[model samples]
Target: MTQETEAVAEEAFPQPGPQARTGRPPRRGRALAVLGLLGELLITLGLVLGLFVTYSLWWTDVLADRSAAAASDQLRDSWAAGGPAALPSGSPSGPAAQGDPNAPNAPGAPVPGGGPTSGAGGTGTALAAGTGVGFLHVPAMGRNYQVLIRMGTDADTLAEGVAGVYEQPYRAAMPWDASGNFALAAHRDGHGAKFHDLDALHKGDPIVVETRDKWYVYRVDSTLPETTKFDTGIVAPVPKGSGYTEPGRYITLTTCTPVYTSRYRMAVWGSLVRVDDMDAKRTPPAELRRG
Candidate 1:
């Protein structure tokens, strides 16, 4: 009776498979599962990195351009509200970017502070930080391309994509200055990329600045394709490496180099050539009108 009963039970129920006998998966199978999970995690990480790159390089430009345009509008509105007497910034003899009024103005230079500036307006006053000073027009960049000019170059200010007047060790000269360097900075790759084509500016290209009452016209004099980030002298009262040993009404434009990286800097230097008063039409200077 016992033998018959045992045989019947064995036949009815089979023993557990090899996995159950060892209480775990085979080592090879376990390794493959772990590898599959690792591959999935790596793919997820790659996708996240790709998304971040797109947002940083592309989406940021869109947001920055919008902010810059709004700021430009606000600045123009402020100037309009000020009226003729308010004089938000210096006079047009009509444009030195605003800075130390007394900075060295090379003798005989047409833009002296007194006794008939190159144009009509006088050196009126200084513009406050974060305040919109004017608009930058570079014909070489694009026929209609222009960016608002503000008074600060810090991250918070430049992030909005406007060209900022430097206020550090080398106080940037005003656009209407009798003499001195009117240096400016902006992002080249992102944040509106205000100065993206700065490198393309060749000697003699017009660089205009539109203020409340005047249009300051400048011509590119030189271009430094690459420089150290710490080279503050590039924006000095008389920018180094610009080949302009004499003091004069000069303008300096700076931005990051190598496309998307900020590891270095580039600069374009210009000198004021003329100033024109803005009539009722607010017509841009001839340089701006040309396609």
Candidate 2:
């Protein structure tokens, strides 16, 4: 009776397996396992993406701003350290050749042959490519917003905390130069993004180019809010569609548009309004004075 009863009970309820004894669920199917793994991977990837965005948007701005400030300080220190040597007689925008009243004059004044002269006096002419030429101050961007102006407008150059001049196809015209477009380019976002507010510039805003010897005052006249990156005419000598029929001293500013993307270009054009000698105290021109 006992053996028969035990056999019946065992048959009705089997012994527990290893997994059941350990209180663990049965192993999942390969498909379920893969899905679980994918879920974990996706979670990890989301965290990585969040970190990347922080680095790109916030951390990069901090680093780029610091780098730009350092570069600007270096340029100003160099200028304060006695600047470049004197220019030779008859050099463009240099002092008039001895006793020659027809000698090239400073910017804003037409030279003997007509048109403004390149005001790169002494050290100005020696500014090599990728070198900082001066400081660009746009009050419309910010009262304290000033970026260094380098000679070549290249990726590496612009990332160094200042704007670069277009050196290929057409070299940028300097502000002191006569009857040409003094063009400049900077990043609209990231890597200092000096011109991020390029769209804020309005007609009549002042763009002051500060050199070691003079301040070239330009008054904003036109702005191309959005244009294809391939539209290079924004930096042209005449800057087609800039409302300028006659060649005169001009300044062009270019930047990427749409913020955080380089798919388009934005431009602001200004004509030379006047020039002021840079005094020992570095007095800004009247054009820079805002009411």
Candidate 3:
């Protein structure tokens, strides 16, 4: 085991020349190939996600707006044909639209747009889901800021890019109701985004509802920046925390808050300030006419 003998043994093995040549590929090569495949897959996935977002945020709005406009046209055509079902039962009489909103309700008093007047309720047949109710006008949104309203607020119903009446949590009153909250909801970003500009609304902003013959104009009274999604009280007969101490003709517009998310809700509340009779031309109210 001397130095001379050790050198002779190393020469016999030739030191393997740094590494023994092998026919099989290195493990690092296989790892790199797998990583390359993964990178390609990730790129494909990213493209798909971008397309989905575009569809959800942009394409859906175009399609929904078309559907809403067509539905609105059909509704107006029905009204022009004078279909009896076009208008709800009851007239703007008694404590419904003419009397004081806070006035004591007379027993069996007729309510506007009709349903059994609940407190400030009315008498009308329950409109089926997707039934077009009216057109909403928000001057603050824009001159052409109008969207059709339907009967139900379900996902399918709201998918048409139309505001829907609160028929589940509560039966929202008609636009002409004397003393009840006529609650409505629509998409905040996609699906026509009827309430996208809701945050731009302020106290005294005009929100008008166009019925077959009347224009119920409401002035934005207050707003709740954020609230729980399960807060059904916002659509109650007299919405709590809506700055309403008593019953009146109120309108509530709600949508998902913080933009493009439904984690919470934001509401803009308004009370009917006046009712204007629609003429043949169907001119908007003064507030709407303003720039």
All candidates: TM-score? 0.80, 0.80, 0.83
> Residues 89-183, candidate 2, lDDT per residue (tens digit)?
12234443222344343334443334543431201242467676788999999876788888888777887768887776666656654456778
- Which residue pairs show backbone clashes in model 2? 116-178
User: On a 0 to 1 TM-score scale, where does candidate 2 land against the true structure?
Assistant: 0.80
Residue 178 deviation, candidate 3, in Å? 2.7
Candidate 1 Cα misplacement greater than 4 A, ranges: 1-25, 82-124
Q: Which tens-of-lDDT digit does each residue in 1-291 have in candidate 1?
A: 699898998889867898988777799788989999999999999999999888877788899889888887877777668644223334434223334344333223333234422211123344467877789999889988889888889998998889998888677777666667888999997778888888889999999989888888999989999999999999987889998987777899999998889999999999888888888778898888876
Among these predicted structures, which one has the highest TM-score? 3
What's the lDDT for all of these models?
0.78, 0.73, 0.79
Encode model 3's per-residue lDDT on 125-162: one tens digit a residue.
Answer: 45667878788999888887888989889998888999
Candidate 1, which ten residues in sequence have the lowest lDDT sum? Answer: 115-124
